[model samples]
Target: MLRLIAATLCLRCQRVRALPANLRSCATLSSAENRHTVEALYNLSVDIQKIRKLKGWVLHQSPVYVREVADLLKDMGASGAIVARILALHPEAILCSPDQVRAQRELWMSVCRNQTELVGIIEKFPASFFTSSSHHVNQRDNIAYFQSLHLNKRIITKLMASAPQSFSRPVGQNEVMVCTLQQAYLELGGEEANMRIWLQKLLSQNPFVLLKPPEVLRQNLLFLRDKGFTTAELLRLLSKLRGFVTELNPDSMRHTLAYAQDTMGCSEAELRGIVLECPALLYYSETILAERFQGLLGSGIRMAQIIETPTVLELTTQIVNYRIQRLRAHGYDIRTGSLKPLSGTKKDFEMSYGKLQLRRERPLFNPVAPLKADD
Candidate 1:
């Protein structure tokens, strides 16, 4: 349903703005309901022209209760402008019956502390709040189920907003996935007391993990175990990947490992060390690895340097080239120096460059001179 709405309601502001005012007004004035919806929205200071450009279909669809939606949002402490924006962005909200909106409000209030927080969440993620009436039962059950697990309310709210599909499914499906994750954590030698924290963090980091089948995680773990990863190493990998470990299947992982081994001429031990250092290498396609490798080699970086700082492989070729060029201008040759400078984010590279600049410009007489008061 969301997909259908998304496909139909693409916001082409430029094209919509190009339409003549007469045509726009005629479309909105074609029916009494449309005129009423438009007048109510206008009264709330909604940019009718903008909404018409984005979702003119709402004006055409009858039985739209813009006033009811406005009243609900206003009751939740939303200002007039917010009410207008919400309607404009997600006009489908007005299409839902008053009963559905009230039910959704109550459902959200279960996790949200008060009206202020509820309004804030709606302001940020309107779609999550104004879902179909059909999902009400599943949403209620899933919320209760997650609460029963002792997961944080904030995390549950986030899951609903970001991964609504998780909450829309029956509680049994999420239960199975959660069990699988807990089992995997225990099997990896995670302590009993820390299981809740681990599970909370995993779900918080990647709620869509609930959507994956239990068998995929089992297969991935088994494949890793067969590839000589001990339980301890597996735990570390899981921690490093932040619950995205389930994204890797045996076949893709096998192909990636083969490519990395062949390209780097590294033995099994060396490859394991590399993967442990940067788990992305286990999931990165051979094509992407080849591009990054070529980017580094093309910059005169040696194979040994890459082996030493495997994390640099995470950076794109464009970023690698830009950093290398900057370092060369600063007379810090990455070809001879360590690849550490290029291993992190853009800010990290700038900090490393600043340190290099300070080292290059420091006065040689500082050692012979007296220290200043501040120094």
Candidate 2:
């Protein structure tokens, strides 16, 4: 009788065999969630263990270190994208410090000897790794802080030993401190004070030439030599030297020549003649000429009128005739005649002089008081 009842019950359960799709999906999701949770915990433990092995830290996993690592990650301020990239690259070290963090930071500051190496290390770490906002300060301030920390003092000393060729313009007090540090590094070897004194005396005399290149100095000296600058004048100019000596700006050549004249107490014409001999100086006068012409035109003076004035006309005509004769001597066809008109538009008429009819279009004077053939 019990077997009969069980068989009947089994037949009824077979008739209701199909479960609803939604209920089946729910069951599958629950199983997947449990699997992922267990896998994630296992991976976390493995990563922590790996970090401990690699860094050779014997310290037991402490809540404080874990919290510190969490805080560091939070302060890193990296977006989710960057965090994902970092994790993918170092999955095993993702949750723990790679080494004794404080010791590593100190080593970074000390072992790397030069600014280039220091900068490289700093660049590798995320900005938040430094912990202090002051670490991100400017180069000068950063150097100072490094020195105060007594970290990497030997490398800093080595870097300071090389003589710096350029100092920042408008140098501040901090920069001056950096300069003093460099000077102190040099003084460690003895006779550094003598070098400073020599530089100071040299700068005191030729302040203008201090920043100028050696080539520029040579060029200027050659120019002065050609201009017959006296020994005293040269000495005076050299003695007043200051920062960043450089060649005079090409555009300022004329003004500089004028200055040279004044400095030497020479006449303007004499100075100008000397300037013309230096091809480099031609750009200055040419620029001045262009400016002057622009000003004249801007003032409403016509160029044609200026050149066609009675005095200028005579001078120009004489020069033109002289040039034409020279060209003729060289077997070139040359023509010279009075300015004349031709039949056309005004411009065409103006341009056709000598090539067409010779009727005076704009006479400067009535036929030079016609001479009598009887005379």
Candidate 3:
């Protein structure tokens, strides 16, 4: 019966049921089979209508293996609602034959501890599990390659779920990028014992780093070195950026630096200090920096104040305006005062505001405060 269902749901529904003997091996689903597949999907509580609207081809080009796919997910311990959501979001999962899906499942299971973990990953990133069958060989090879490096199985599972493209590439390509990162870590004075954990954190933070060309990383590191970031400082910056250092290129970095220097009228050393204090300065584009600078300057904030607390640039113009308005309403003058009070996350801002409000409301006599201090 399972084989019968698999044959009935084959994608040959899109093809004409006529041809040579070898081609005849593929079955063509009649209207009855298509209706049955749709009905089965509906019975599974799948939003079949939503899927049809989102991917109309599911109705004509593909009458999917609804039962086979749902059963596979169920065996993996996915609840009925999750199974329905996955199918509704990515109806193409039912396009693959049962054999192909089982093969994919086995491949994923090699990295995953069990079917339950795999289902959790699928729930978060449905497309990662439903990648093309053509990449299965590459995926298998890459999993073995990562294992050979002795990376934690948990990290490997994360790479598969969050950055499946890294596994879909040929093993040789990923091997080169991995080697580049390892060499960079060693050259930056990273300890041998810490390398494994560092690599795991890097991959977990930005698995897409594996997809960057090794040369880009080399060039970016060289550019930073020229800009006077020592080996230790480079390592710290890389960690702070969460492995996104590879995402920078020399030209863009130069452009952002030039903008900062010209606008703030700061020397290279001062600019470097600012970047170390607020690494976002290194990654934000000239346009974004300009908008933020203008917002502060327009609000009567001095360049000297920005230099003193560069982190305020991390906030958007609208946030800066809102915060400044709130501070002004409380009779605080940010233009003359330090930007430190405005330079952190929303919770930090709220804490600072609370303190300011208390100060404003406190009695000058402070009778309770003096008694408490004496006590």
Off by over 4 Å in 3: 1-33, 325-333, 347-375
Q: Rank the candidates by lDDT, best first.
A: 1, 3, 2
* TM-score pick, better of 2 and 3: 3
Among all candidates shown, the one with the greatest TM-score: 1
In the range 1-375, model 1's lDDT, one tens digit per residue, is 998777656656555676555445544354534666776776677777777788778877778778888898898899988887787788778888888889999999899889998888888888888998899899999999999988889889989988999888899999999898888888889998998888888888988899988898889889989999889999989878867988889999999999989989999989999999998898799999999999889989999999999999999999998888888887888999999987887789889999988887887776877787873
- Runs in model 2 deviating more than 4 A are 1-198, 201-212, 241-245, 249-375
lDDT agreement with native, every candidate:
0.86, 0.38, 0.86
Model 2 Cα shift for residue 238 (angstroms): 2.1
Give TM per candidate. 0.84, 0.21, 0.81
How well does candidate 3 match the true structure in TM-score terms?
0.81
Worst 10 residues of 1 by lDDT: 24-33
Q: Following a full C-alpha superposition, what root-mean-square deviation does model 3 have from the true structure?
A: 9.2
